[model samples]
Target: MSIDTAPEPGRTHDVRSADTDPDAGAVAFRPAFRAALDATAAAGVRVHEPGTEAYRRLSGTFNITKAVRPLAVVEPTTPDEVATVLRLAAVHGVQVAVAGTGHGATEQMDDAVLVHTCAFDELVVHPHERWARIGAGVRWDAVLEACAPHGLAGLCGSSTDVGVVGFLTGGGVGPVVRSAGLSSDSVRAFDVVTGDGVVRRASATENPELFWGLRGGKGSLGIVTAVEIDLLPIAQVLGGAIWFDGADLPAVLRTWSQWSSLLPDEGTTSVAIMRLPDMSGVPPVLAGRTTLCVRFAWTGDPEVGEEMIRAIRCVAAPLVDLVGPLPYRQLGAVHADPSDPMPVHEASTLLAAFDLDAADELVALAGDASGTPLVMVEVRQLGGALRTGPDCAFAHRDAAYQLFSIGIMVPEVAQGVVAATSRVHDGLRPWSRAGGLPNFCDQAGAERVRRAYPRGVEDRLARAARRYDPAGVLLAGRGLRTAADAVG
Candidate 1:
């Protein structure tokens, strides 16, 4: 909704001015002058800047804290300008942070350049060709709106408010994942600017290494300027959530684990155990109690979908049953994730497979009998298209399931909340996949970064990083192995 189309600033009167021709005039001061000019130019899109109201509007996942304050926010309107900004930043040794719709954001740069790509927003739909070319700044909502008219839809996350580039770059898992695979798996090509400032196009045929690295590898390799991905012919879907009372938690969780595995490839499902706080916006029946919510989305016939979902709905006594036919645009309403952000602490672990023991452990830590105030604990069943790797680059193709825990930080009970969440993770550690989903991993460090990709995939990404960023100016968090160290 926020787009800035402004004219460039006129020359500034200072001690020195950049030479009109870099080869001919004022060589001594032109470099500094150009740097200053670039800095001034970059200030237009900063959300935290006082007078820059547009920049200030860019909110993060947890809006309670305004922690990140960048030196300048740059919104490059074109791929050329994106490359220009990256090159200039590289030459000036300026650190850069790439952001889209700032969900899943964890860290902040002290005095670095933050690239805000909202201006680069563009969505080109090729319905007959079955693909979409989206600008890095585009959100899932825009793409959905564009593609809906043609009976096609892109692979998007649970919430359409999230950005395409950031979501797909992190291996997007959504309602349709079981049938279509992760969002990254749908990527056909990408336009990116590496840390060294080169603007390049990567695909299975072009820059194959870069293409492979970007799919599952987080933003470590470079900033994606544009992405082209395949679309599926799915308009109306049978999807929504069915809620059950707290007393039914044990039956619901156990039944869901077994039921989810039996789901056909056309179906995707997940279960959430929530201890919702008493609040006005919450439904009265579920406001202050632990409840089990089984969410399902069927990409096939509505009748078949309903029949499949009916088995679980009958698992226990129902408190609310809203699962039925709905337009794809109504996807966000299914989960009803909190729109207003707060200080949220999140952690996730992938599983090799979920067995009865794992289900029992999850119930013990977060179920009604556990007395944990953890907002919601979710276990998304992963298989079907998600289990098999497409010919492309995404690496987490073999993960059997994903477990996520989200909790708001209450100052008075912060330590207890942390302990409870840790207990949940520790309980599942025995069966947890050593890796994690990049979209859910929020800790900012090198070790956590490595956990997003497999060892072989990490080594390949490191090699790509070396080929592009030889200077090693970009510091990807946690155990980042540069191209040199990758060789042995």
Candidate 2:
């Protein structure tokens, strides 16, 4: 059973000698690690060394801006194997980071042991129970396709490709958020392995504290193996975007903001100013041009939705109108996010109010006339069901709008993106709230962690982290370590 002697049935390779370097502080605990690795390998785990091709492929993320160089990347096929990885990391004094689709890449891993959950692709839908059990690696698109035939829908974010577990753990906000609330609010249970190497089922009736912390705490608490979430009885929705020329930015933005404030709970909307590149997949009219896109999603009657959206339609002459009734699976068209992988830097804030002055400020900074380097600046309306969700770790319930900006991470424009994002934040400071959505805070610092949660929730999360992960082996949100230390 020695780690170096033989490879188990599903185990890929033996532990290389280079991985046992004595000078390496945490990963170099040789004697105890051999036993831990042997046990994990015997249980069908594959441990890939730093320079190996498997390690390189597993260490990469969807956010190309972050270059993760972990000490080792472990691929665990079953929940037992996941527990073994955590136990091995704890015993060897090495940190562990979970990568599920790698969309939300933060600077939370440094010389840590990364667990790639891509192989845990399990998806089962219970039409009678109106719930679905999805693996940590399953994407929203897969869930959507599985539930489509049953006239059900998962509360997936704008991009259907985003990982379900990561999105739900971070309090996912999607196109139907105003109607269905956060994606986390629908979770019935989660099968997770804490830093202590214990597999526990968390739910409202089970480990309530762990459930609350995991709902909005992201990966700071544990690595989720599978999640059971409630699905909605929604088959179709009247949703899409109406594009207008940049010349009408001011009028369209102000009109949409004012109109959105009067919208009902069934109608959700957002406005974005995009500077799309001239790529092949991009429409010729929108490519390389500053455009104003007004996105809307209505769960009500299609006729009523059309009547309600007519006010914005007549605000200014639109360049294109693609809004109409469509199946719920086509929700991605509402935002039209880039599907290709590219390096990007993003910054976001929740707004207390968005008035004419806020619109003017946005136009002066990121509008067509501003000559900004940022690609897209979006303002999404918030409230309704989103404000009435059950008390969880998610904060900013009373915020009126969410403002976020994204820019390419090219070497020539990296500094420019940072400066422009800071300027945008400063310009909208008057309307900005204290906290932001957990999913949108892309940086890895204590201040960003504090902003993701409210005043009291952070303390509770810190205590939970100490109780569940005393050794701090889970490095997904190491910034929260500062909060835990302050409370102690």
Candidate 3:
């Protein structure tokens, strides 16, 4: 959240000082400033400074490589406290960054106050209303566990460990996206603290413009404290994964590319070629070798679902076949996403299509004997209900598929991991779309902004950013400034 200088091109700064009026006078985090933040803690908040365990823990992020160290971290229990922090940052001319569970953290916050929403860990399910009101700090796992007993489902991505607010704000695409639509589509309302030190509620009828912007704008306009999300009545789904030996990759990829293109809206699917590490959480059968996994989730009748998946299972003798009727609460099993915090380099591209030629190129670049350093390469089937969501700031509804790659940044192969990711992606350039989802991609910059949103959409997001965050005191995260030159 450093604000001493304007953000350099392609670099992400968590916050920018509102006092950009060249004559506003330079500000620093002097002793009196530290004392003021500490004093505000008297009203249900705590300020932790550097070198302390609390500060380190609160300032940490899932991707260790992008870990940020702010001058101080503050945990506020109420939205008022959130407003107080923003107001003080505005007056004192300090920058502010927001953190929620640290899973989507993208860059360094060098020297500023980080507003961590850890203290807003509230969750209340209204069984009769068929919705849940959750705080920013709550993760999908908690929401899933809480709603399961009542036979309800909260749309969540492969990893339930990610924070609910962060996921929704970034236009959430989950395991059953084709059937359920984007996760952000389920949000009913939000309680937020704007950069002007005001608390506001946004919904379809209230602050309608802000509601549209907040859905896919990330933390640009405001820091969301809580949200009311509509839940699905789905109790279980026909879902899970089938794994095959990497030797069968070529056949598997070709079959998947053709099959996924024909999948109905009632069915959602994705395929991943994995090179699992031999670690505590890894199964011996999947460890230290390449494997191909076909994940599917069906929202319709079970018998038809099984019949639909038979085509994939028939492609090869599976190393592991776990696809079956599954409780919606256990959906994370489909992708088996990592739960631990670690360093990772990620990249993604949306595709106009994933035809046979695209499949062939992928196999040639990352086949079993290709000597690739990437840990995983995934292709998710997009479209169906995903393309029909209501008007909102979310973009790229016309993309037919999404290719995402992840490389663990272990020191020995960090450089190789990044390079190989590019090689594979560049090799498949023929079918590649020019943009990406804001939620995906390794780096945050102008390129990512252009990649995530079209000119018309980002223009609206930029306008909303300027309107809601007039002084630019909030973190213009996910390329807020790149779209709007008025921002710092």
Candidate 4:
């Protein structure tokens, strides 16, 4: 098929073995493989083998704990380059892992070829068309910066540093999620390379099934080269957060839960019980103490937004109140997510109910006097446009809320952090549902993912995996498949 001028990978080759997996032993690159990679036809692709300084630098992942040394790291700039890597992987029966900017990496790609997409740095904004085309390498910050002048922005998650493709493909849940729905719903089209070296365009009118599967299926189908997504037209949002003392946790959490349950779709809200470190950038008042923070983002009139937010503010005396008008480009201020990478262990579950009783339990599980090692435990109200949004692979729209917990993975508290995460989820098990959001369950294995998708979504993903990635070239594709029915 005729397509856009993308790329061809593996113009040069440096071969060595990482042997990160002890059981797998050493891996070798054939002379034929080296020659293919060095061919003049493979003009623009770059390959870095293990044991080199460049490979070590490029292979480092954002999550420090889940690190792996793959056999080779392939950096591709275009669709043809991505296709070439996948084609060669399939032919040589080598496993491949698609590491797009590496934020959401879950698996250790042992003896596999790592396809890193940092070079797919293409971003083109079509202001009149109300959409932007971004490469897999692009981050939400770049998109927000490019679109801010035009009064347009994509529905990005709490952290703008996250890669666009990984977030959208996993069905993004943003600060404005309740108002705007999942970020994947806004995707217009995708330029992806399937496992068999086929470059395809997936949209509503072309390869519709693939389009549906790609929206919330992560990389179960293929590696995305570029994507087009609808951008919202507006300048500012009533976005910011309020913090309350931890001593008032039970009352504050319960009050916010009741008030937020009645919140309108125009407003998106989440509350977090945080224990901030007494370090730089930490507010003096909240430092070394537990605090409850309520983040609010209102897309409608600022006056009405203030009216809705006033209820939570009045529940308790705020240690700090930062709720007010904010530019769409500054939406990340609402969540105040840490900009730098850290070792973090996280867990999430959909809640069937989050009433006054559940709120009390949550406070006990992760509140001030609980002696919990968790850094933050949050609950996000979900409803309105989220339940009514265009459907694809995401399930559990009827869920009333979502429970998430994060713990920093420093050595002294790493074990405690993991334990605390399990405790929080186990304590809240009564109100919890079975499946987890794709974006939340980063380390979930195939069987766990199988259960994570209810309503036959798992079966559909497995079938799509077989169809697009028959040779099991992509690790995520192999994830959705069961052991009984093996792919090539």
Reference-based lDDT, residue 139, model 4: 95
lDDT (tens digit, per residue) of candidate 2 on 98-146: 9888788786565577888998899999998999999998999999999
The per-model lDDT (C-alpha) reads 0.74, 0.85, 0.84, 0.82
Q: Assess candidate 1 and give its lDDT.
A: 0.74
Per-prediction TM-score: 0.88, 0.92, 0.91, 0.91
State each candidate's clash count: 9, 0, 1, 3
* Clash pairs (backbone) in predicted model 2: none
After TM-score superposition, what is the CA distance of residue 240 in candidate 3 from its true location, in Å? 0.7
**Model 2 weakest lDDT span, ten residues long:** 1-10
lDDT of 1 by residue, 150-204 (tens): 9888888888888899898888998888888878888999999887778889898
Q: lDDT score of model 3? A: 0.84
Please provide, for model 4 over 353-423, each residue's C-alpha lDDT reduced to its tens digit, 9 standing for 90 to 100.
88888988898888889999898999988887788777688777788889999899999999999999999
Order candidates by lDDT, high to low. Answer: 2, 3, 4, 1
Off by over 4 Å in 1: 1-52, 59-66, 391-393, 475-488
Instruction: Give me the displacement of residue 218 in model 2, in angstroms.
Output: 0.5
> In candidate 3, which residue ranges exceed 4 Å CA deviation?
1-44, 486-488
